[model samples]
Target: MTTTPFSVGTFADGDAPPFPGIVVDGRVHDTRAVLPAAASTAALLTDWDAALTALQSFADAPAGAGIPVGDVRVLAPVQPPGQLFAAGANYREHVIQITVAHRIGAAGASEAELRQQAERELDERAAHGEPFVWTGVSTSISGPYDDVILPDVGEDFDWELELGVVIGKVTRNVSAEEALDSVAGYTICNDISTRSLIGRPDVPMMGADWLRAKNQPTFFPTGPYLVPARFVPDPLNLDITLRLNGETMQKGSTGDMIFTPAALISYLSCHVILHPGDMIITGSPAGNGSHYGRFLQPGDVMDCEITGLGTQRNHCRTTEH
Candidate 1:
């Protein structure tokens, strides 16, 4: 009695508008055919519990025979989430690499000294530090297969592949122990950034200008689909990998994260009411272009994947003037 594994996403055929679809065995079945509440992926998420039940039922006895996946255009699982929260510097190794490269906080220190200092700081932060979370405009989202149009203003566009968590129920001040219960599903996201625009020379004390550096259109390439939380056994143990033009650029395990997804969600919920369809992207692993002294160029391609969520392949092109 083996059950077919399934995920959900938005898709379109020919010129038809996007609709929520259940994906199983490389086939797409219109979710509306079974669940009228699924007018859109966002709408379906509003009642995620009921939606999950109906989706599971549909998976048990699917109708319409599901269309071949290749025939439809896959869109981002949730386009322009109601709210998008991103955690930065959550991975200890990534922080150590960045700290050593930039000489952060310990300027003029030797590389070995910087590495030792960064490790000690990470240990302290992991024991008592809150995640560095921030708001991101949802319009930056693009489909998994869409072209990432490098903005004209920035010279160093880089990739930061991350795990995206989708909120299911209304979540406020949830405890870390119970945070997983609030998750609807998980997806893959590439948090693209403009390295040159991250700092503000005009206001050095103000810290990194995340909005300017990261919120450009098509900067966030998310989802081939969203796998329900039930399908993922352990969010913190998945492997995250990314390749640029067929060369592996980033590869690390979620185990390296200083603040786990549940912790980040719990921390975020303390401040804001997380509604269904809101997204939280956990920070990326080490190996951003900045670390390697490489940056996106026209015609570059990025291939990214997490263990079970899915894969995303995006082409990079300069925006037309």
Candidate 2:
């Protein structure tokens, strides 16, 4: 499938600019000051096939007549999604850390014991290596360069960088082989979380419920731009990295995933219906806060990047109640 090539830009320090050759009347104005309204909007708005088609026509216009690619302010490819789905423990190393952290107390178990227990658990889980999925509401979505608000209710904010997939069409019960067909593109996402909410003891599930921690508003920072699936022939072989205030924090690759994107889509379709504009965060690699004793603090900055997809930079701030 061929996708129209589009450029992404962000405001240097404020609201999106409205330069005539940049973005005018809410649509991108190419170099000739010709407004391809639909294309500009379609890139950000999904489930609007007509708009996307219009965008293609606009992009095809003579080079000079097209919007000046460098003029417009580019924000995250998709501002909000219809549904945001996330997978947990999708990597062997991550799962091991989660299991040990949850089962053993805050004191943390010995490395030898942790490894032994993880090995045993893996032996059992390998037979049913399925993705553990959860949903994040639309309110939690933030732009790649937007600020990530740390809730004042807790001080255990953390970060998990993962590859996020954007659904292009409505789909249900799709096979693993057909999964890529339904994907429109990919982006980088930082699953900012609060450990206090995730580790709550009063919850009926005995802290088994991590949604509260993971689903805080503006917690999921995604995109600089969505690289059309065609640009990335293999989503499972990219490098991923996370940094805190210019300091390297975590580094790994999609190759470490216990469940691939195809398998994850297949597993999710068995229970829920996915549609255009939906998002699926494929899970992170090792070195998350829960495992390394590192947690996010206010005023901290996080920069995450995926090989094919672009970078996402967000500053930590206190969330007002």
Candidate 3:
């Protein structure tokens, strides 16, 4: 793909319902109108290289082809990827934060000692550990600007803004040396969490309960754009910023990822085949709501951004029981 702004979305004109659109600047160019074959974002992903070529041609066409991105509702970038792969504790600082909490209950570990152990573990994991990959249901996805319906009980709802990687090709056991070739692009993903519900108390030894805590409706607010790989010169260097109610809550960078995008792809592919449109959202950085005890509440707004990919603003609401 060239340096063309390649963002695919679903938008409707005057309540006519939504259609796949290629977002260029502030305007939305219809993908179905321009190229019938590449009608939906999923369809476009099936052959990303060709779809990108078609998009490039349309982008260079005469100015009268698209309409302004007015008040049309912007749906999730596409249907949820065929598989959603999320990395856990992939950032060095994130490990530190998680470690501090986990070891806080340890009998004799000092705070400094806990932090040191966490840092050391990060280095060892990056050098020899396989990436920890988890699966998420696609139903959790909502529009980029959609309202997040918080559960009525879990009071520790938090925000974790991370970069989402969109796979473009069929890849199996691909080497890290050539993993970038399989990536289609990147997007912004907020892995909203009900922190208190992560563990299963009844099944004392089963470990994390990802499905219950992370798969609630509107739990994952994804994408205002799908920035093609070519546009993001270095995925590891982008800045990630997220604010709650206009107050900066999470501020970090992809550079801190203990498992880089390539590493995660290579390690993950060694086990399962990655299909086109599969997403691997690299883990969130430190400074989550847990850090400051500033968990999300109804009426609070979250503004998340990942460099050139774009920003997403979501409001929090709780439906009456």
Winner by lDDT between candidate 3 and candidate 1: 1
The candidates, ranked best first by TM-score, are 1, 3, 2
Across residues 1-321, which tens digit of lDDT does each residue of candidate 1 receive?
Answer: 656679999998998888899998788999998887568999889899999988888887887678988889999998546699999999999999999988886667899999999999999999988899989999999899999999879679999999999999899998999999999999999999998998999999999999999999989999999899989989988999999999999999998989999999999999999999999999999999999999999999999999998889999988782
Candidate of highest TM-score: 1
Between candidates 1 and 2, which one is better according to lDDT?
1
User: Each candidate: what lDDT?
Assistant: 0.91, 0.70, 0.85
The candidate with the higher TM-score, 2 or 3, is 3
Which candidate number has the best lDDT? 1
**Ordering by lDDT:** 1, 3, 2
Where does candidate 1 clash, by residue pair?
A: none
lDDT of 1: 0.91
Q: Per-residue lDDT of 174-253 in model 3, one digit per residue for the tens? A: 99999999998899999998988897889979999888888899998998877788788999999999988888888999
User: What would the TM-score be for candidate 1 when compared with the true structure?
Assistant: 0.97
TM-score of each: 0.97, 0.80, 0.94
